[model samples]
Target: MAAATASSPLNLLGFNRKPIFHCKLSSPRCRPTFLMPPGRVPSNSIARTGRTFSNPPSYVLTCLVIPPPPKRQKPKAIIQFIGGAFIGAVPEVTYSYLLEMLAMEGYLVICVPYNVTFDHAEITRRVSERFSSCLDSILGSGLPDLGLSALEVSDLPLYSVGHSNGALLQTLTGSYFSERIPKANVIISYNNRPASEAVPYFKQLGLVVSQMLPVAATFPVNSVVEVASGNAWKLLLDTAETVVPNYDLKAFGSFMTRFTDQLPLIINELAEGISEFKPTPPENLESIRELYNVQSTLLVKFDSDTIDETDQLEETLKPRIETFGGKLEKAVLSGNHITPCLQELRWEVGNVYTPADALGQVLKNVSVNDTRRLATTITNWLDLLSH
Candidate 1:
C-alpha cells in the first residue's frame, strides 16, 4: 500500500507541506539509555509538501514504527504502544527508554501518536484506524527497512502496552488492531477523567470558543482567504494528526482576514459542531461497563498516583472482559502518573549493550529505575500470555 495521500491546491494559510520529525540525544526528555540505531519513520503526509502559504506547517502524524536492536535476534513480537495525552505527541522521544528497552529485548515497537482533542472516544476510534493503517503499510512496503530480516511476519504475537491515556484507549479497542493482537491487555495508570479535569479550564475554553465563533466569523474575509481558510480549518481540526515539536510559520496573510485571534474556538465548532463535550464524557465512561471487550487484562497502579482511576477501570473492565472469559490482574509499581514520560540517557561506565546504555552499576534516578521496572513487568506479563 502506498499509504494514502491527499492533494490540495494552495490554501490561504499555505501550510501545504509534508511534516518531518527530529529528536536530539542530549535532550533530557529524549531516549538515550539504549544503544539503538536511528529510527526509521514511515511517511505520513498529514500536511502537504511544496505548497508554502506563508503559515508554518504542522505535522499530524499517522504512526511511528521502530525495529529492535540489530544485535538482537529477529523480533519476537510486535509491541503496539501509545502513551499519555500531551507526551504522546513525542512517543518515540518521550517513551524511548521503555519502548527501546522492549526493542532491546527483541520486540518491534510500533508507537502510535495522536494529537489532543476533547472528543475522547473519537480519539480511540481514530487511533484504532491509524494503528491498523500503519500496520498494513508496514506489511505492504516497509518490512525490509523495518529490519524483519526473514522472520515470519504474520505469525508474530501482538501485545499492547500503554500508560495513562494510552491505557484508556487500549481498554476500549482492547488494542485489537489485528488477529495477531491477543485478548490480553496491559494498562498502566489508566484514567478516564472529564475534559475539564485533564485540560485545565476545559469548559471555559469551550465556552470562550463557542462565544467567539460567531464573532470570529464576522471578521474580514477575501475570496482567496476564504478558500484558504477551509484547508487551514481542516488541518487544525484533524484529531489524528501528529506533529513535530517545533516549526517556524508566520500567521499573516492579507490584512483582510483576521480570524487568527479566534482560530482555536472557530476551528472547534467547524470540526466538532457547535456543541462542546468533555473527552470521555460521563456517557462514554458509563458505557465502558458493558462496551469493553477483551480476554485477559493486567492493570497497573502507581504507588503515588493520585489522579489515576485504576479502581474505576477495574470495577468496569474487570466484569466486562471477564464476562467473555477474560481475566484481570493488578500490579503496584513505584512511580507517579508521569513515570512513563520520564526519559534519561545512561552514561556507560563499562561494556554496555548499546553506546546509549552505560556499563556497570551506576546511581540511577528513582524515576528511571521505576520505569525500567515497569518495562520489565509488562514484558514478563507478555511472555506469560504468549504461552
Candidate 2:
C-alpha cells in the first residue's frame, strides 16, 4: 500500500478534523475544537452569552488516550501531549507516529488537539481544565465503559508533553497548573512568540490577498475559511488511514458533513472575536512563580528551527526552575520546527522496490531520523523521570 500523502500541500496547518464527540462538535472526538480569533477574551466566551445566543461553537479539551503497550503488564507513565499550530488540532493524525512510539513503550498517551487562536493563555487553560475533566471521566467508570474506562494511572507519574506551540502550553500547564501536573514537563520544539508571529502563515497569506483586492471588491472571511476548510478535509480523507491510527474510512462522509455544518459558525466566532479582549494579559506570568510546583522541565530545541523561541523560554524558565532547586534541562535535536509532526509512512512494494519508495523516503523527513530519534529521546527522558 502507498503511504498517506498530501496533494500540493498548504505548507502546514488548517485541517479541522471533527472529533468523535458525544459532548461538543468543535473538539476532536476526545476533545472539543474552537478558533478564538484575535482580541476575544476566552473567559468572556464562557461568561455565558445572551439568553438567545447561547452554546457558542468552540472546542472542549477532549483528548485521544491510547493504552500502554499491549504486551507490557504494567504501564510506566502517562503522557499529556499537545501539538503545535493548526496540526495541533488533529494531533492523532499529525503526530501519530511519535505518539504511537511512546505508547508502545508502555506509556499511556493522552493527545490533546486544539484549534489555532491568538488567545494562547485562554486556550491553555481550556486545555488544562478539559484534560482534568476528561481524565476524571475516563477514570470514573462512565456509562458504556469506553476502551480505557477500567484502566488506572492515578499512581503513575503524569508528564506534560508538547510539541512546537504545544511545548508552550505544556510549559504553562506545568507552571500555572503545577499542582496537578506531577513529575515534569517534556517540551519539544518550544515556541511562545506573540500573536503576530504565532498565527499561521496561511492566515498571513489571507491578509496579503485581502490587500490586493479591488477597492470596490468585498469578501467574507467565512468564505475564505470555508474554502480552506474544504481543502483541508480533502487532504485528511486522502491520508487518514495512513496517518491517523486505525482510522475508519466509513466515517469520512459523516466527518465531511459535520465539518461543512460547523464551518459557518466557526467563521462567525472568528468574526465576533475581532475586537474583544476583556480578560487582558494573554499570558500567565504574575502567579506562575509562586504557583510553579512542577519538579523540572526538559526543553527540546531543533537545530534548523529559526522560528523556535525555546532559547527565550529557557531564559525565562531556567531562573524559575532553579529558584527553589529544580532542574531545567535542554537538548538540541536535528530537524526543523515540525520534526515532531512526522507521521509513519511506508509503501509495501507490490513486487519490488519502486520509485515511490524513494518518494516515501523523501516525504518521510527532511532531516535524518528526526521523528524516531525524537521518540527514543523522549522515551529515555520519561524513563529517567521516575529516577
Candidate 3:
C-alpha cells in the first residue's frame, strides 16, 4: 500500500517515536505507553517539562531553615588588695568593710596580708617574702586552674590596689614579677609614700652619726667641733641631695600637713611615743640605704585639702612613668582617707565612735568606683577570650 510515514505511526501512539507493544491488539486494543530508563532524563529536560507533567508547581515545595548562632562567653576578673603601714594593728573591721563594698559591686577581691612591722628593715624583708608567697599562690592555685573550672583563666583580668606601705610593697612586687605574673591592667596606689624616700629624717641622722662619729672624735675640741659641724653639714647636704631627687618634697609636704592635721590625735600619739625611740642597728644600715634607692610607683588620692600637693606629685611622676611605658592617674575623692569605714557614724548625735567607721568611709569613697570598674574590665577581657 502507501509508503509508511514516520509522522503517521508516532501520531497514533501519542509519542515522538513508535511504541513497540509485543502483545495482541485485536482483543484489547492495547494502550501504548513509554517507559523512561533510570537516570536517562536530563535535568534540563525535566525542568523543561514543567507544567506538561502531572505534578504542578503548587503540588510540591521546598524551603531551607538556618538556626541562629550561639551566644558568646564573658571573662572573669580578680582584684587583689595590699594593705598599708601598721595595718595589722588596725582592726580587720576596715578590711571587712572594704570587702563588703567590693563584694556588693560584684567583685572577687582578695585582701592580701603583708608584713607590718614598725622596723623598716623587718618590714622590707617581710614585704618581699609575703609578696613572693602571694604571687606563687596566685599562679599555683588560681591562674592555672581558672580555665579548667567554670571560670576560664584565659579570659580573666588581674588588678592590684595597695594603700600606704602596702602600695609601695605592691609596686615593688609588680616590678619584680612583671615578666612572670599575669599583666595587671590597673594598679592603684592609695596614700603611698615613695619607696625611695620612705626613711624618716631622724633615722637618716642616726645612721650618719653611727657611721661617721668614730672618725671625728679623735681630734682637738675646736677641730672636732669644726669637723663635726662640717661633717653634719655634709651629711645633711648629701641626704638632702640624695633624697630630694628620689622624692616629691612638695607632695610630702602636703602629705605631712594633711596627715598631721586629719589625725591630730594619731600624730599626738606618735609624738608622745617618739620619746622612747631607740637607735637603728649598724648591720641593717645597708638595707636601709638600699630601700631608699629602689624604684617604685607612688599613688596619692587627694581630698579637698590635698589638691595642691596631689597636682604637684602627679606632675612629678608623669614624666617618669612615661619613660617606663607606665602611667599615673590621679583621682580626687569627696571624702578623706577615713570616710568609707565611718559612714555608719555620720549621724551619731552624741555617741562615741571608733576610727574604724571613719577609715571605712574614706576607703569606701576612694575605692568603690575603682574596684567596680576594675572588676567589669576584667570580666569583659575574659569574655573576649572565651569567644
Candidate 4:
C-alpha cells in the first residue's frame, strides 16, 4: 500500500480511482444493439432427439422430444405435434425445424408420427398416458444429448399442434382427452372435408384406374411397397423401375391403395361423425363439445393451399364454440399445402437439417424461411393467447 500503480485502484476513504475510470469508459454508446426484428428469436437455444417406445395397449409410436435451452428457465408449456397422412415416423417430413423453434420459445415439444390407419383419439389417449408415465424419468435423467433436465413440471399447460389430417384428428382427440379447455389449439392447413369432397376429379379417376389394374389387386402391393427397403424389395423396385416412377413403387402399388383402400375408411368414419341421424357416430361435434371445450383455437391457412378446408371448419366451429364463450383465430400464411410439412426437408437421404437446394432451383419451392415464418407466427399467436 506504500505506492499504488496507475493501473491499480487508489483506495482512500472507500474511493477507488481505477473503478471510476472503468465506469466512465463503459458508456451506453459502447453497448451493442440487437438490430434483428423483435420476433426473430434464434432457435439454437433448443435441443432435440428422436424417441420410440411401445406403450401399453399394443401401440407403437415414434416421437421427437425437444427440450428447452440449457441452464435457462424451464419450458412453461408442452406441445404435442401430430403429423398428417403419409408423413413418416421420422424427421423426414414433420417440419422438425419448426418444432425445434417452438422448443426454443420455452415449450417442451413432443412430435409424434401419425399414421392413417390408427384410431386417432385412441392413439392420442394412449400416447398421452405414455408421456405422463415417462415425463418424470425424462426430466430427471439429465440427458444432455437430448437437451433435457429435471425441472418442475407441475401444472404446466398443454397444447396440441397438428397439420392437415392430423389437425382433424387433434380436434376429435382434444375432446377425448379431457373436459377442460386446452391452453391453445394450433391447426395448420386443416383438411376438414371427407375424401369424396377433398380429392380432385382427375385424382379420383386415377384411383379408379389404379384399382382396376390386376397387379395392384394381386399380392399385398401396398404393404410390400410400404416396407420396401430390403434387398428383395430393391430388386423388385429395379425390375419395375420403368413401370413405377418413384422409389416406393408408388405408381404401381401404394398410390392406388392410399386413395382407394385407405381414404374411404377415413371418409366414412368422418361422415358418420357429422351425420345428424347416425345411431353410432365415431366422433361427432356434439360429442366433442361434451368431452372438451376448445376455448381458444388458432387455424392457420396457407394462402396457396387449395386443399385447405380451415375456413369451412372455422365457420362450423365458431357458432358452436362461441356459444360457450370460446374464440377462433385465423392466419393466412404464404405457401402451398406441403410448405408446412416439408419446408426444411432434404431430398437426399442422410443429409438431415441441410436445406437441399439453394438459389431458386429445386424439387419444391418451399424454403427454410417458410418454416421460420410459421414458427414466428405461431409464437406471436401464443403470446396473444396468454394475454
lDDT of 4 by residue, 1-387 (tens): 111112112122331112100111144432223232221112221111111111101111234566655544556566777767666233322465666677778776666553354254555565455444334334333334434343334335667788876787667766665543255788888775534354435345545555555564586754663554343455655665543233334222332233234444444444334322121223445655455466567788787889888777666666666666566677777777877654442333344444533433354334666667787887766655544
Candidate 1 on 1-387: residue-level lDDT in tens? 011111111112322212111223244433212221222221222112111111111212356666666565467777778888766755644676777667767777777776655556677777777666556544432355445532244446666788888887787665333333444577889987765576566556667766776776787544445656455655543421233222111221211123332344335753444334444345656666756665567788888899999878777765575566556677887888888767553333545475334332343455488778888887776666554
Which digits, one per residue and each the tens of the lDDT, describe model 2 over residues 1-387?
011111111211222222111332233343313333332224233212111111112222355566554456556766888887667755544566677778778787777756655566777788887677666554444212223332334445677788887877776676666346746687887765644354445345444544554541466755655565466566765676565444444334333433354444333444444322212223444334445656666777778998887777666666676676676667777778877876545434456778887777776554337888878878876676565
lDDT at position 91, candidate 2: 53
| Residue 328 of model 2, lDDT score | 67
**Sort by TM-score, top down from the best:** 2, 1, 4, 3
TM-score against truth, every candidate: 0.64, 0.66, 0.39, 0.58
Each prediction's Cα lDDT score?
Answer: 0.57, 0.57, 0.35, 0.52
| lDDT measured at residue 148 in model 3 versus the true structure, 0 to 100 | 28
Model 3 Cα lDDT, one tens digit per residue, 60-88? 00100010111212223445555555442
* Global CA lDDT computed for model 3: 0.35
RMSD of 4: 18.2
Stretches of candidate 4 off by over 4 Å are: 1-62, 91-93, 118-151, 179-181, 198-227, 231-292, 345-366
Q: What is the lDDT of residue 291 in candidate 3?
A: 26
